[model samples]
Target: MKTLLESMAHGCARCMYCDDSRGTDIDHFQPLKLAPLRAFTWDNHLLACSFCNSNLKRDQYPVDAAGDCLLVDPTVDDPADHLYLLLRCGEYDSYSKKGEHTIRVFGLNRPDLVRGRRDAFCLACSKPRDWHNLRQAGDAEAGRLAQALFDSPFVDVVHAMHRLDPRRAEFVVGTHTLPALEHWQSVYGG
Candidate 1:
């Protein structure tokens, strides 16, 4: 637990599956009962929320027709490749079979989670949207807002908004000239 916390700077690092809640438990990706040999292995462990660990996941690890895990490892895979964020509704539109399974199994689009994500995205975007009023502010102000977005709860939701076209991301920005908007573009526009 200490190792996991230290690695993520004690911020819960968000749930590995849902990318929302603070990870609250040490979950064995491969259940100990299913893979006893790896019980003490490092790679086999990941941080998860109690809800995911005990309720949503609960020792259920699905496998493909070839017996490969359907779950995507955050350390080994790019989640965005399988899932795309819906900016307006704050839901996910899956692009793969694994993505669908991951979303269903983890309740990734649960109403509460979607609402929370929407709220976070809106709050983070407000910083850039209000940049006109911040022209006289110190250079570090914009950086601080961006940092706050990264450190705040539901960061995955906040970061996901950056994947959209700037004009489509109404909360973020529609035009240039705002330092906050520029900072967002510089960091995530690529």
Candidate 2:
């Protein structure tokens, strides 16, 4: 079960919630105590880090006024629909109740995670230009660089950048890097 959950995780099997640490815990998205009937259910399992599963979320499950789960299930939902990353600060802003709840439960804005996102964003912004340079020079290493960029930690940052409007993306990554980013997005499908 743990193996299966890990296989479902994104970017080198990172934690589904934080997308930072390795997913070492087989977390029950719906805690066994709250949903005992789902104990053996595959869809109820998720890959999580120790910090997210044990320290933060634990067995708590918050629901909205409508009784719908407030947590964002990465496997079943598009997190971008609820949460948006602020490129300047590496913090996430919530546009939905579920996003807000999930941020609180997962500590998405924790200092370490914020720093990681910021660092990853900077690196992501730079890598496209590097790839472009390598490709322009006809270097064989371009593919490897592209793969590493895609597999980097905090990959959600890159995805968010891709989802940005052209003007905003150009502003965030700068005009020089924007074209390279767009080229990579076109080739990689973001």
Candidate 3:
């Protein structure tokens, strides 16, 4: 139990499904009802929000027509391959079928989640520019901002916006000079 809690602490505490809410439940990535044999397996366990776990997801584990999982596994697949956030509208746009299915099943684009994500994005985008204006600030203040940015919810939204930067020469996040996003990589990484 201590080990499990430690892993959650060292990583993003946000729900894996919505990435907006607190991870209040340790969910079976493959539901126990559907795959009982794997109930106690660590790889099968994922931290999730109560809303995504008890409300939206319930026991549903969507599969493709051929019976393969349609949901993006945060531990395996890159979520960017499946889903990208529409920062302007605060909705997730699908780049793959898995993304569409995951969104439908977990209600990732629900109004409440969208609002939260939008707020996260706006602040993540604007705060860096603000910091740029206050260029004379010391490392101590910058450190505080970095801590706050990582502590903020729905940080993936910031990553999504960074991915779409006009000056993004590489497809990776290495170049986007958004303040405090470096803190995000240090914590819960993509």
Predictions in order: lDDT: 0.70, 0.88, 0.72
Q: What is the alpha-carbon lDDT for the whole of candidate 3?
A: 0.72
Pairs of residues clashing in candidate 2: none
lDDT for position 44 in model 2? 89
Which residue pairs in model 1 clash with each other?
none
Query: lDDT value for candidate 1?
Result: 0.70
Q: Which stretches of candidate 3 lie over 4 Å from their true place?
A: 2-6, 9-12, 134-136, 167-190
lDDT tens readout by residue for model 3, 42-145: 77888888889998888888897799999998878999999988876688989999999888999988999889887886687666554444444544565566
Displacement of residue 21 (Cα, Å) in model 2 is: 0.5
- Candidate 1 TM-score to native: 0.83
Which candidate has the top score in lDDT?
2
Model 2 whole-model lDDT (C-alpha atoms):
0.88
Weakest ten-residue segment in model 1 by summed lDDT = 169-178
Ranking by lDDT: 2, 3, 1
Better of 2 and 3 by TM-score: 2
lDDT of 2 by residue, 2-116 (tens): 8777666666999989999999998999999998999888888888899999999999899878878999987789999899999869999899998999999999999999999
